[model samples]
Target: MPAESAPVGRRERNKQQKLERIVTAAAELFSERGVDEVTTQQIADAADIGTGTLFLYAKTKGELLLLVQNSHYADALERGRAASADARTPLDGVMALATPIIECNRVQVENGRTYLREMVFGDPTEPHHAAALAIVGETEQALAETLSRLASIPAAEASALARVVSSIMFLTMASSDAEVDIAQIVEGVRTQVSAILPR
Candidate 1:
């Protein structure tokens, strides 16, 4: 059969629809009441699925946060990458690449801080932690690519710089008492980028 005419199996479609419902419900609740206040049973009720089904999707509330935020983080990375294309300097490029993430995190700043903390110490074997790692790796790579082009540096060097920048950015935001200041982050990134790039 032609690729365009290929039919999706019923079970697969059902699984995907169920997963979408879970994410949608979780996102809504988590946004309205904070992750710490929400429960699996409540999420299941919102999703119109059984509590057991909800557990199958996310074993814990933390995992549910991961499931809901993964795509948002991915989209932020993409926007950051696109924004970097218009940068006039290496520092500008770096800041452009980081701005979207700062803005995205601001939407749920408290939960964003908690998610960062969890990723630092969470079980590596868990699916949610793995998904967080994948997103982090992609963000680093995008930063590295932008830095490499803007700084005219080797990819390896740019990658190293990107890692440091990513660490500093995360730590800075995570250390904040409440919402992160994107402008502060941009200024800090400018200093770091200037220090690393050739005079």
Candidate 2:
């Protein structure tokens, strides 16, 4: 690389490293004590950064939740995509794609609730909002691509099917009672997909 690009790369790496530290610290505290109990100063102290710097990373506690969980969500989506490759049918592939996401949300149920609510109704121009959209887009694209390949459908048609499945998955996760079983919800997704997917 060019000499000038070296400094830019180094700056980006440093920024990413700091962001990771903050996210790690925040995730631990949020999971252990809950999002309602944590404070920005506590996160900053845990991250070993000034409180001012924490604001640079996230404007509010909800945004911090997004910053912390974004990568985990991305990872779950990737795992879903990888697992979908082994699926024997379109329904199986859709289940493979949806299961990991539900599991990821189960990791921190309250935080997941907060994150999803904000994602739906929060300021669309916020960085965290954009991150949420990107994660959803990636999962949808993966599902669409998998459906297109497995079912021998046009990409556009597969994309529409993916959206339908995605909506059911989201509703299963988002609207269900807190006491509801994950398997039951996933089964609901499977049933809905079965009724819709082409034979």
Candidate 3:
């Protein structure tokens, strides 16, 4: 008598794998070719799917770009969370979070450089714009949470500090000549936090 193997219906898994592959292919091409120059047909070819098939997952080229950025950012956020989990000080914890920010930038430098320059070609009037804004808002919230845990700042103050540091992250990412030394940024943040509190 032989043991029976467990059932394995792979359609969903296969579909997800294909979607990931497609996104990876798109990110590579987009990084190399700039988002504006990389057409859906090119993404389809890169993904080994037809243009129509690519369109099935993404409504437009802009939507595909959104997917890439959103996925990449999510990965970075997970790393940030893991890095900051054991931080003792709010500054230390927030600093841990910022390391992932640098790691994320280093990993996605090319695609990000291009994407920021092109602004994803996302229409200002589209509902997708709100979705993108929400992503930024979530990032700010994460920063605020870290700050809240690190110091005695009120929620409002913590949120403001988070926004400030985030603005620094954006600026640092954009400046090739101005590489963000996370240590320096963290120190600066600590100084700012300390300034608002007393003995």
Task: State which candidate has the highest TM-score.
Answer: 1
lDDT of candidate 1 over 12-33, digit per residue (tens): 8999999999999999998998
Better of 1 and 2 by TM-score: 1
**lDDT of the structure predicted as candidate 3:** 0.68
Q: Tell me the TM-score of model 3.
A: 0.67
lDDT of 2 at 122: 74
Give the clashing residue pairs of candidate 3, or none: 90-150
Which residue runs of candidate 2 sit more than 4 Å off their true CA positions?
1-14
How do the residues 1-72 of candidate 3 rate in per-residue lDDT, one tens digit apiece?
A: 999987666987777877987899888887787677888988988889888778877777777777687666
Look at candidate 2 and tell me the lDDT of residue 99: 90
What's the CA RMSD for each of the models? 2.0, 2.3, 5.8
**What TM-score do all the candidates reach, one by one?**
0.90, 0.89, 0.67
Model 2 lDDT on a 0 to 1 scale = 0.86
Ranking of candidates on lDDT, top first: 2, 1, 3
Per-candidate count of clashing residue pairs (backbone under 3 Å): 0, 0, 1
